[model samples]
Target: MSDEYQTSGEYLHLLSEPAWQALRTPVALALRDAASDATLLDVGAGTGLGTEVLAAAVPDGDVVAVEPSPALRAVLLSRLAARPDLRRRVTVVAGDALGVDLPARLGAVLAMNMIGHLDPDGRRAFLRRVAERLAPGAPLVLNLQPPTEPTPVPFSVFGTVPVGHHTYEGGGSAEPSGPDAVTWRMRYRVLDADGTALREDHADYRWHVIPADALLTELTEAGLTGEVGPLDVVRAVRRT
Candidate 1:
């Protein structure tokens, strides 16, 4: 592992499992209804939680799982390697949303907690790529979390999250970095039954948040018709 992400990679895949557990089912349902049995793209698929959902929702469909982080992708591939059924339905790729080539005309695209990693221009470019690769009327589901309230607020997101057989102990802090950005730093420790810390990880990220209306306009310009849904969701359909 590279020094940049070595310390951060251990739990980068496990820490988010709790949140994804709640969101994955609904996402699978949405994608299944949108265009099941078609190629689906799981952008920034992380540890492949979303891909697992997609696999179950559309058993006959294929998923292009893309993640840029090597550590995360390693976890993702390992997970998939254990599931031959899912492996048959998924093709894992290590690339960002903008750089990766579309494997096929996508029936749907699920991007969760990913766009915030991009700047304004990068976001636009990514949307443009989605537009280009999307089949007409295909859905592009986005999980765009709202920024934490109030600038310069002291924020600590901490919890003991259970995954499969083990637990993860993690906490995070974030501060407003700019009018449209936040600097978030987090650390985690994977624990065993005996309270032994098996491995530790950390990450620092700067998220760029664009306003809802502005994002809608950008999506519209990118040939997607969309509306904001409950819980910070932006569901868009490729224009025919």
Candidate 2:
């Protein structure tokens, strides 16, 4: 679960293309109306993918890229070395989303594909903390996978099972050598009370899905107005 493995330059390079493409447009549009002088935070900013996007959007503003993995932070630092303009505007911090104190009041907070990795309690606590840190009317954008119902597999045992049957053997399980081997991918959805589709926010989400209704309720309780947009994304803003 540690982010250390993600710091590889090869890995970071591989991710650059998709991460920029998926986040740039939506994020740019979201910040289009903000003043050029606004400040921003990119949470879980692995390898500066989202940070790069934010940098492009707010050239005259400041960006703080907070990442938990030291390895990834190293890569991010190296990447920033080449772009002097961005290097001046961006500050890289090594810290977890749940523990770090945001350095300044931010105009926008971007949490992309990072929520699900946290345990349930951590997720709720993080959201509440985000509400507290945001400036009045500031927007918090969270992209995560929706939880899906688990599929059940039925099995029956007519007689007592031997204890040795459950013991592991060195041989272990057999591997499928061919591409035809069956592989399953879980799909989830985020829906409002009226069954409207909310945009899917992240390509890789870590934890169990958070229901849309539950999200809205949490936002309301945190003193924010939650809006689930058409793209499976949720935008919550602090009340004015």
**Per-residue lDDT of 6-97 in model 2, one digit per residue for the tens?**
42323343434444566567665554433344568888887777787677766777888888877777778988999999998898877878
Model 2, position 186: C-alpha lDDT score: 22
* C-alpha-based local distance difference test score of model 1: 0.77
Provide the clash count, candidate 2.
10
The residue-by-residue lDDT of candidate 1 on 79-156, one tens digit each, is 999998888878988788888888567778989878888888899998988888777667788877756332453556
Error of 1 at 88 (Å): 1.4
Models 1 onward score TM values of 0.85, 0.68
Each candidate: how many clashes? 0, 10
The lDDT for every candidate, in the order shown, is 0.77, 0.61
